[model samples]
Target: MSSTGPLQPLTEGGVKHAIVGTLEQITIALAITVPLGLACAVFLNEVPGGYARFVRTIVEAMTALPSIVAGLFIYATVILILGLEKSGFAAALALSVMMLPIIIRAADVVIRLVPSSLREASYALGAGQWRTVWTVVLPTARSGLTTAVILGTARGIGETSPVLLTAGFTAGLNTNPLSGPQTSLPLATFSLVGSPQPALIARGFGAAALLLALVVLLFVLARAIGGRGPGELSRGQQHRRVLASQRDVVRMSARRPVPEPAAPDPADS
Candidate 1:
């Protein structure tokens, strides 16, 4: 009897390979997207008038771009035009493109919610526009900005077409984003489920379950990191408060009137 089944791949570390590839794709996507998105949000917030409006409109429009379009764009630009290989990096580029619009639009909204009064206060404190944005506006919108990033992650993570077109599926673990094929969770599951074997289909379901767990884990981690909003005292803030109190105590002690050696002076005299 011949055993021709997808389970053969599972028994040979397929699940682990898929898990690593998925994580790698997301990590790279986030690293590229977050900063760019934040910067776009800040620029849109700081700049006023027609040009900014025009740019914002374009970014907002991009939010509606299809995943396959993004994938094809990356495939064409990076793989074909730039002559780069179809690798995890190319896939990450596609994911980042998909993620960017979501993040930028959401972050712009969050930044806009920051009170004008805060900006005025920052200006009154001698802060420049950029400084005001960096210190006051961004901090005020920290939680919302975190949410924006998470929203982008959610938008990109489950995208099959983009990862499929750009990432190119691989059954083995490939850590190097710049070389060779890497498969994301959705792509991996897609590949596994397409196999004509019940065992492979089961493996695909398992992969899907793992992907869901990964999303939950990411959300939890994001919440942990971005839990505090403006005016909320974090551990660092609490420590600063303690230090300030200690300094006040020291200053008060230093200012206390010292009995001028009056007793000794009188006794000596």
Candidate 2:
């Protein structure tokens, strides 16, 4: 339906392929990444001492590692060793590894952001540490954890080099991760932009825009549902305010004066 040249038809196919591939890759990446990332975060957040710092340092370093490095590692280890050809599943695994540190750090930060007083209160109520973390910490910081996972997924979805090297560029739709050439959205854009067709370039732009839209959608959706509710407003801000209010109340009560002795006591003195 586009008269904009040969680029147009090529682009339509590219867009369709990119959208489908990206979605498939993201689904796989999230499934494996979220639970593991959160688990790592829980350990780091709940545990104390120099050990946590060591783990945090490792995660922080991993977060900044280049995408190509992750791709190479996966290619050599999983692809070469397993004798599996480049596939979407491999790409997803590569992306998940790259994404893990981000989600873990984000979730750990959120868990730490939970009020110490809340933990104390839970303990006061005879809750065990594990129970407190499971029931209190997680519920309170659920939104942040969800947002972290979503953000990690969004970050992974845009990966091009990893998908290119691991997933490979294929012309047809592939739903199965275990076999066949699967074309992903980023790889599609990378492949299409090099073409001399203006229509293809436009399609690339549209695809890029769509990818951005998806990321934004996920972030907003996750943030909206994270924490208590959208109506609760900023969870961190609310939590801080509540803490301050409690402190003020405590101070006020501490300052309250006891009743003066009766005049009869003064007469006796």
Candidate 3:
């Protein structure tokens, strides 16, 4: 229907605009959420006492906050107060807000699971708190962190209300997220599927299928990249292991007993 149909909405750009808009929203949301979430997680893990607990409680509360609420919050704060136009950035901000709590909580759990002994070992090696966290704690929790990020992405990408409220959907492709309207997959699907025309409905289904495929691809790529945990050696780690083995061999060879008995035996013969 998209190829030969009379529906301009479906066949005009072949849903490329929707695809690009979804990618833009997800990318921008992740870019904002990941570092902030990780930092929050690290802070929560490293800090002790009532303040951390209070913050954790707040984040946990936010985890249950409705997507619509998030959208409204951004709409009021960013769009209304800041006088910013409805664009992909506003949508991204909403999505980021929705994603942040999930990522932070998951990351906190993962970082906490990182053995305390590793942190101790780093400190024993004269590493400071920040250095230990950066080098030891984070790498140890890398796989779990990746999982947290993926989970957040999955949740944010599927949300329609927030994007609809903030993004102000457009049919045409708008690459610049900061200016003009953008239409994500979920928003596009919702808009198209709501149409009275059958061709538009078919295109909506097609857009939904495309969104599903994109999500699957992201999941696969994330798994492939993050499947390896702390126990698995990367290329640099393998090289370092090889170099250490060579050093050990050299040290052992140097410490081996010299052959004074052979000379004595030859002289006796």
Candidate 4:
């Protein structure tokens, strides 16, 4: 091998492609999982009765499922039934299944945190159940929705076994998830650690660091973007709050009696 070969381990082009492919897989998985998970959370939180309980039970059980089992299920259903080859898309779909329960649970907890008073106020204004939920409940819990998405993405990015069983690690660039083999950081690390080369081993550590950095960066970005900054609101709310404060001040001012002239005290001027 050329001296340059070890310097630029795993084909500089290959490493770049791997990073891109892994990002694509994670994005796709989150795209599917987030909406589905949010909907599940909404349903579970809003609907009453045994049916909702049953659905929640099913979702909770799914959270405990092994990653390999999810991978095998996808391998059987998508790959085998449809005769699709191993691909990043299939792997992302499997990872989305794995992430769904976590997203749903996180979202559900946040939705539940919404105060009952908010719902009462919405109803008092003649808003329907769905409208109240969409407008008031979700806006109140936007931070949690973002957090759930981050959790799902973190779980999806580092999953090795499922991606291995579905998306085989290939060296070349694969932009098309539907057709070509895709390499991820997890796959790269696994491959390098299994090899005997010291340089390759070091590269694996670099890859791990890169993955960790991506997760942390995404979490910070999500939190930054998730909610309205503190106290920022529509003009109406601001006006109402200002009015309430003024009314309180006026009420306190009116209630205070003029201090009667104090009786003359010794040595007072």
Candidate 5:
């Protein structure tokens, strides 16, 4: 790998920095987005509050949020205002913002598609609202949720503008995303392909191809993992559920009241 950032010769430059940077950024971004998105989706689907409509509208608008604006927002608030350096972490924040709405909106639609009958059955069994949502609603929407997550990943992974604005280019690998500049595959590809040299252009295309392959691989893996029908648990999940039920039984047994000894058969005495 070249020691110089994005200015090294085609012979000296390596893709390792870009690969590591891309993975780090996406990992951080997904970590930030997924839980929040799912919570928001659940709220929108389960609650019919007036504020929910406003939140839904905001999410819908954000789904169309421009990449440059995302970049600019981070650049202004994070880099400029917060005094953080241009680094992978900053870029990840921008990516998370771009991804959050897509995931929330998609997941909300998927959860809404779940049958009302399942929820009714759950309630009839004396399950609480949260319990029904946890055990019934989410499981039924598993495949669609997976698809939603994959769609958000696909959207954020290929973004060059955010990375460029926040993650300053680096030729050498930077493992610590908390500090220092980083370069993602898309940013590297954009830089290389813009050069007049045919070799750099070809390398850029190769990087692009690799990125495409990674995205497709992620989609396939997600589909395989989430392919089961509604309420169908994997063996591991079944085992855990069994263990949980056993614990519940033990707990109830411990809480059972002792019967008072029969003191009143004294008529015979």
Candidate 6:
């Protein structure tokens, strides 16, 4: 974090800038990749037509594609042809390209794991194919979908070559990812570890450690979000559930059918 050099003063290089830049790039990349990946997966699994196999083959091929190639593709198109400067946004685009296939493949598998009975029931109840996929299918496989997203995130976040090619190098902090050069933790670690200085090398290791911890934290969060039973809820969610039930009772009580008083028998009268 300090502006000081990787000099002899035992300067500790913090990854604050790298962390922020990574978050910015990843946030943008996820925003692009998640919806598109999910849609592609849905199309592949639920709506597989004549061309579905071709698309699936392409996604499978892209899964094994080299990261440097994605970076070069972005560099040639966005930078060389479109006249965009080296920025974190461009790096994020490259990351998106890398992440998209992983997400689509993982999500495709997850969506395919949905029980055929569920779709049959949904269609029997007058639901369309797309609606059934959107409502019943997606929710049922949400935990798996979250896992797929985590996989994609793991693939994108640790990538140094793509980030290095597009994001450029920066020592100081830069918050605006769309405008200027930015740095990610992996890139910072790569840059620092290559230096001849011991202090810089140590900082590089520290940055690498930080990146590992961040990935672990993300996995924990994903598990927390996705590892729930179908009818389970957190304490707060449970409280809300009760509150909603009470409100529903109140709202529906007036519509409840009232039993009429027993009619008197003629002899009793």
| Best model number under TM-score | 3
TM-scores for every predicted model: 0.82, 0.78, 0.85, 0.79, 0.80, 0.83
Question: Candidate 1, after superposition: displacement of residue 209 in Å?
Answer: 0.2
Deviation from native of the Cα of residue 231 in model 3, angstroms: 4.0
Candidate 5, lDDT over the whole model:
0.88
- Model 2 residue runs over 4 Å out of place are 1-14, 222-269
The TM-score of predicted model 1 comes to 0.82
Encode model 5's per-residue lDDT on 97-204: one tens digit a residue: 899998998889889888899999999999999999999999888888888898889889999898899999876788989999998999988887897877677778
**TM-score ranking of the models:** 3, 6, 1, 5, 4, 2
Q: How high is the CA lDDT of each candidate model? A: 0.84, 0.81, 0.88, 0.83, 0.88, 0.89
Candidate 3: the clashing residue pairs are: none
Listed per model in order, the count of residue pairs whose N, CA or C atoms clash below 3 Å is 0, 2, 0, 0, 0, 0
lDDT of 6 by residue, 1-269 (tens): 54767674544457789999999999999999999999999999876687999999999999999999999999999999999999999999999999999999988988877888889999999999889987899988887888889888988999998998999999989999899899999999999999998888988899999999988887787677657543246688889999999999998997899999999899987
Checking candidate 5 for backbone clashes, the offending pairs are: none
Decide which is better by TM-score, 1 or 5.
1
TM-score of 4: 0.79
Q: In candidate 1, what are the lDDT values of residues 47-102, reduced to their tens digit? A: 88899899889998898898899999999999999999889889889999999999
Question: Where does candidate 4 stray beyond 4 Å?
Answer: 1-14, 219-269
CA lDDT of 198 in candidate 3?
84
Clashing pairs in 4: none
User: In candidate 2, residue 21 scores what lDDT?
Assistant: 71
Global lDDT of model 2? 0.81
Compare the candidates by lDDT and give the number of the best one: 6
For model 4, residues 69-110, the per-residue Cα lDDT tens digits are: 999999999899988999999999989989999899988987
